[model samples]
Target: MNTVVSYIKEWQQALQSEIQFLKKFGSNKFLVSNGRLLSTDGSYSYYFETTTSLRIPVGSSVRLEWGSMSQQGRVLSSEGKGVILALEQSFGDLISEATLFHDPWELLDHLIERLDEIKKDKQKRLRVKKLMDPSMPANHPLEKIKSNVHELVLRSKYNPVTFVWGPPGTGKTYTLARTAANKYFQEKRVLILSHSNQAVDVLLGELTDFIQKKDRFREGDVLRYGFGTGERTDNRQAITTTELLQNQDPSLAEEKEKLLEDRKLVKQDIARSFSKRDTNQLLELETKIARVLEKIRQKEIEFVKDAYIVGVTLAKAASDPAIYEKTFDVVIIDEASMAYVPQAAFAAALGKRVIICGDFKQLPPIAASRDSLVTKWLREDIFHRAGVVDWVNDGRLHPHLFLLEEQRRMHPDISAFTNQYIYHSLVGDHESVRKSRNKIVESAPFPNRASILVDTSFTGAYCLTERTSQSRINIWQVLLSFHLIHESYLSGLRSIGYVTPYRAQAQLMELILEDLYQEQRLNADIIAATVHRFQGSERDVMIFDTVEGAPQSRAGMLLTGKDSERLINVAITRTKGKFIHVSNQAFIRRHVFQGKTLRQLVEHQVKQLQTVETKDIGKWIKHQHLKLQWMHARKLENVFQDIETARASIVISLPAHTRLSPEWLEKLNNREKIVKLTVISESEWMELRPDHRVAEGLSFPFIIVDQQFLWLGLPLEGTKEIQPPFVAARLDSEKVSEYLLSQFITRE
Candidate 1:
């Protein structure tokens, strides 16, 4: 199959998805209703201030609409209430107030433009000739992928597209930096770009460190010419473009001042013209201004032309007219999995040779389109779209793909899980991790182990959700987590994270942890967030709250959907020292049988894995025998089996006047053990007694059998004729039943 032909179709789908994303999250999601111009960086861009706190990521494109004038620009930088936008149209004056919009169309337009050019390009050095069969000539041994990135870049003369799959903590960024710096030493122009601004700064910062230590390098040689999230960088001040033009080079600075001053005078002269020949004079003056602007553009280009390494976001490279004028020997995309197809395509076209770096098993581009084709082409990263994932899964390695598995962020045992389960044992941890495994401090529950599965079934921490919301929360689990987190804190593990699939659980933990840390005056570094928010980050200790055990009894859609092993892989592999997974063992096993992603998690954690984080947290572990089923529309026969088989006790929360069936009575009579039973009903219906309890505003229609099995959702005890058409799910875990009983039984 012609991969370029597919990309043409994928390109169209991605544009459509971009439209859908904007339509869905346009005005409300990104609103700058009232903002003012703060300052201008150069003739090409203006710095604006928003009235509200804005979190627009750097390098995002935005639209400014006020009165009859509407313009688009790239956000060069973004701070709390300030954003610097490099607009297509420049203004000498600033507006006190204007409405700014967040539109990604401009970013797509650049990609589309570059894609069209790629389709027309004929050179083998510029574009991949056989995209379906990409190759890297004279590639290094698989063991030296991390060490030989620069050599691969130099050796891949005929091949244009090369991919590097760097899993978490594999030092991909460091490898990228070393490659860029080494290329600089060889006098090769290197352009580094990423999907996010923060990533740009991080890479630029790393690049700065490496180049600064070099004997031949000096300040202003490498420039961080764009906006990133970080307010500060370790790079020298002269590394910025503004610093280079205004301070680093004296001759360029003098020429820029003269041209700008001349342009300013000409604009004033045109504004003052009034004679009958004023039109001619105005045209002449405008011509003068245009000439001076060209001179300024040339000088700016000259300043950039001398730089060996330039770092920016893909949007910046696409939007900045200056970028299209230049070419690079090597183009590197860091965190490429988070990049859209167009971004990668555009960057690929910018350089004769390309290096796309990322872990496809992590986050892909975050788009809101539900179209399957759009999701495949627009949302999936380059590695996925180009069949690297397919080849790897089929036990075959792609010629163009290089793998880096020597990670130092996770323990060897913890890395083994992702190594065996996620990557199919294709790569293993480095010796650093192997040696560091035994150095772990014996923290309370996590003594000498890197990972643990905290089975909530035995701890009475049943999962729960509200009547109206799907964001599940297990209060008992939260409490147990907080206790363990606190223990880890006291044991000197500072970098901790409590991550769950539900926002409600994260928020709840946030509030409690915030209050507790403040109350104790403890300097806590713990973070609680959803699974998606924890990507591209690592922690010394992490608690994976696999919230699943409620009545829904199903795994998360993002966890069980197509190719969802990536997300689950990210969730489980973000910890370095210790990992704790709190989940309902029975629910996942019963309901998570369909998806390969969730099933692998179950088989690996429930059966194969043996290391438990902490034995102390198992204070509530108590195994009890039970049986349960889900019945819909029909109860079949022996509907009262829960009551009939109760050996210890039965807590029936139903109408006081309700009577038992004959089959239940016969079974109870035949049992040798005397079972105690309590009936809970409305206060007005039943008086407070030892056998009969009165409850106010409490739900009752559930029967807790020996505090192990729970009969819930529908009343199957009444006559079959009076039964309503309803669905019911019987929980068979002892801890779940006890937890449910505690929730239903009102003591006050």
Candidate 2:
């Protein structure tokens, strides 16, 4: 058994023994309020209070004793106050909370013992083979999988523990599926696990579809285990092995159908009694339905023992005693980065070969206490810890670790920023993702464009409370994001996602989006979630609201960690076509010294904007009607060649500082005699001050070739550096060219 499960079992036994002892000798008559306990026996009463507000820890079992009856319950609290002391009627009324007390420190002692064992175990060290299978063909099943070279290398290594570093949109699930399928096809029993049931279900669905398409496995070969009733009923494809077994057995299937039908009848009877307000009949029917459901559950568990390939959530799989008896050849853990180290270890202990698939750079494991030593120690996943020392650095990956570089989800525009800032430009570029197939009913103002930055420029205000260090949403940001959503909906671009760093902001956005959805102003399926919640998901368009707007305060504190950088990466990469970042530019600039990813992104956007404005090359080419000329002193031969192709006369100009070869000057002089060639120099042109040049439509060393085409050569000045020392051509603008020529010929 794994250390965590063993510790849990020991704790449970200790709790049970303590409960038995308390029942035998402890006081029965007690009063409880606000998680405080006061024992009262006849005339005497003793109130037990601590220095701090008393809190009953969640998941700790509580037992109550009265007369001949003993009842067990759990403590459910709100802000350290025990709201429901007794919970159920069987547990009786509020009793002494002191009797319910069990220090988790005792539980931690067992956990500490386990941690020590893990630290000392040399067998737990990750091992990898030095060589791969040389006989494997080029067209092997693994090769057919569209994964990166890193993934293929990792799959080749015969490692006890292998890690797949899957950044956002990097096909982590697909890689896991391929690996698991390969193992299964090789006659190896595989156990697939994940942090959440949803993740497990997704992997299971993908695997089942993949194997079915290949005709490699029978219908009952792979089984989904430990899914709850709702999950079993809702997902037909992911029916538990027990359900499949029951269906295959004629007697069991009939009995199960009869129970379901009887339960349905009871539900129908209860619905009818609700109209008549018959309380007794409704109560009896509800009890009948509950009994039938329990029977069905028990029968399902009984048949699950025969499954060959099983998929389950980590906690459920670890807790199942039957799983410990059977060893699998390979255990595949999806979303491994989000699984706590101990939880992952528990899952990893079940298999000889462990494969962990997840992106450590997306989101770390969630923890309850940031200050606790145990919590802090357990926050880092095994995959992340392994990567820290030996994986994916300096263009070389560890033999056992695979870094998936090709992201097939986000558009190149959306992925470029994340690729450069987060992945160090190691991610592969798939140009096909740039074209979004989402149907747009109405074209937005900026339709089918690259990622954009919506610079709010410190227009919003942020709130930070003492209760939490994180900043809350600014009302202005919510309004601005809502406006964007409205515009997106109007433009027919649906599948929008709104992501924020703060929970309060996400909640507010959710409310605003819901209202807009109800009013038919926004898409009904729009999602608003925090960055952590939005990880491992994607959308057609994503709007990020960086809630830190306060410039004077230490707003930088929130975005100053590797985790924050990962959050920013996940947020920006979730969109396929458009990434709309809403942040205060002034605030970001002020705290840019913090070296946060968001600030870096904003700075990149700023540079891109400046480059686009200064060098409007596309705008120049669009207006020039295919008749354009580029002149440079270093490339005079190329310029002469370009001038020779002009159907009409060509005009050439040079600044005072520009020096040309005598051969080029003779070639230009000869061209002047052959065709209408006009050459002008800065000194020969009309003299005008910098301010007057714009009004006169005249620039230094100006030339008007073919009467209709104008080339203005302006020198680089101030902060703007000129390339080629030339301005864009003006085509079909005779008036502007005529004015410049008239002024140039008439020297002052």
Query: Best-fitting candidate, measured by TM-score?
Result: 1
C-alpha lDDT values of all predictions: 0.65, 0.55
In candidate 1, what are the lDDT values of residues 23-57, reduced to their tens digit? 45654334342232333435355544456667675
- Report the lDDT of model 1 for residue 157: 42
Model 1 score (lDDT): 0.65
Off by over 4 Å in 1: 1-6, 25-52, 55-101, 117-151, 154-158, 231-238, 242-303, 437-441, 458-470, 518-524, 606-748
Model 2 has an lDDT value of: 0.55
Quote the RMSD, in angstroms, for model 1: 13.3
* Total residue pair clashes for candidate 2: 1
Can you write out model 2's per-residue Cα lDDT over 279-368, one digit (the tens) per residue? 343334434545655665565555445555778877666545556446677888888888766556656656776777787777788644
Per-prediction TM-score to the true structure, in the order listed = 0.68, 0.61
421: Cα error in model 2, Å: 1.2
**Error in Å for residue 396 of model 2:** 3.6
How does residue 346 of candidate 2 score in lDDT? 54
